[model samples]
Target: MRRPSGRVMVGAAVVTVVLLVAAAGGAAWWRWDTQRQPRVDDVVTDMNTAVADAVAAAGEDAAVAVSPVVAAADCRLGPLRPGKIFTGKADLYTDPGGEDALITTIERNLPPRYAAGRGTAVAGVRPLQADIGTVTLSVRRLSPGWLAVTARSRCSLGAATEPAAPTGAAPGITAVTQLLAAAGTRPAGITEQRLRCTTGDIVTISAVSERTDTGDLTDRLAPALPSTARRFTTGDANRISYRDGPVSVIVASSDDGTAITAQHTTGC
Candidate 1:
């Protein structure tokens, strides 16, 4: 048999090398794709496991401390549908008078990761727990009288650390001032008559004889007011209260029942 020419031999070697490289590349791509595509069943299983673990950790207690956060790498906003809310692990220490305190704490301490608008309120509440770091308690209000609450506990991956020491600093006054500015611009039946500010960021506003016509007041004030503010009936037939942020403005018809009287809180 005649030996193949050097050119032919070289060409053969090149073809073999190209085939080997292509095979290796294809294998790598296949491995990457398989690793990237999380198995649906596996994900479902993990979620179920997490939920079960959270419930088990909470035990029979209505409230338990759990981590509000889960694996950061896998963190997701899951199915938080409109008219619904979600709260991760929380510890329920005591039942407050109402959901207002809880809402305020959440707003001040753990603001939402995303806020579509400044005054937009969460439509509903949904709470959950994590088996592993921060305990969280959460609640959502559906309507004036309807609410849902949940609590859970979580664990941090690191070793136990000392609890953070509490600070005695007074609450910031700016919060109240900002709240007042927002309340003043409301379009309710009463308009701002006078406003006073004190050293501690306290604000007091008095509103006088505006109008008795509910239709006009609602038309103007309701549109401008934040969604968190609402009109609710009171014992007095011709009186109503507008609550926005931390301030509650009481509006009552004047003795003559033709004008409205509004009084805002001190240092709201």
Candidate 2:
């Protein structure tokens, strides 16, 4: 067998280095494309913008870019009717910090309102934990416009809560999450808990407890609530009101007994 010369060895080494460099460059470009936020126009443009911003702000490895729930939505925001809904969802690779990191990134990037110039409306984040927890946000358009962002999600996310003014808003998004955990039989027991801090502060805790009879679901959850809270019964809805510093907490239950909600309103 003939031995290779020095020239052949040198050429092979140089080719190997070039291949490695190309691989690295390709990886970087893929990350940028996957994480870059999406842009839109008119109706609910801010909605798409907000979700995209939140995912990019997350600083995590997201698998895909922001995508419209409706394909045509890419052209412009849709559902130009009152109470019409538009949704967008993006998935993120989990970070070492767990849910806290995801929640913080979302709250930070998530917009408080659709857009200042669009009109007068509010936006809020409500976090829900099922097999895998999710956060959902809703935007209500106060005036007739071309855009309305109904819901958006990052990670394992979902939404449920009424829109409220940002007056005397809760301390932070973290506090709102803490409140939800404190007022439940179990975090998993509450299927949906939404927190909105925009023009106003609102937190809604919804519980569908298997431990209690459907007829007395509210009765079961009321006792588990913070002792400082004053419980009020409005027909079938169980409303629990409490104050922590400037934030006023109201926990309510649906009359049907399937859901219990907590709202930290803007005012007492």
Off by over 4 Å in 2: 39-149, 152-199, 212-268
Clashes of each: 26, 20
Report, for every candidate in turn, its global Cα lDDT versus the true structure: 0.36, 0.37
For every candidate structure, what is the RMSD over all alpha carbons to the true structure, in angstroms?
21.0, 16.5
lDDT of 2 by residue, 1-268 (tens): 9988999999999999999999999898756754442322232433434444444444432211223343222221223211223354333323222334344444455445422122222332223211111224432321111112334433211122232323343343333345445544322343222222333312332233333223343454455556654332334324334443333444444456554433332221
Q: Model 1: per-residue lDDT, tens digit, 1-268?
A: 9999999999999999999999999899767755554333233223323332322322222221222222322222223211112222222221323334444444343323312112235443222212222233334553442233343323122222222221232232232233323334322322221121122222224344434443234334444445776444332244344545444444444567555444553221
Best by TM-score: 2
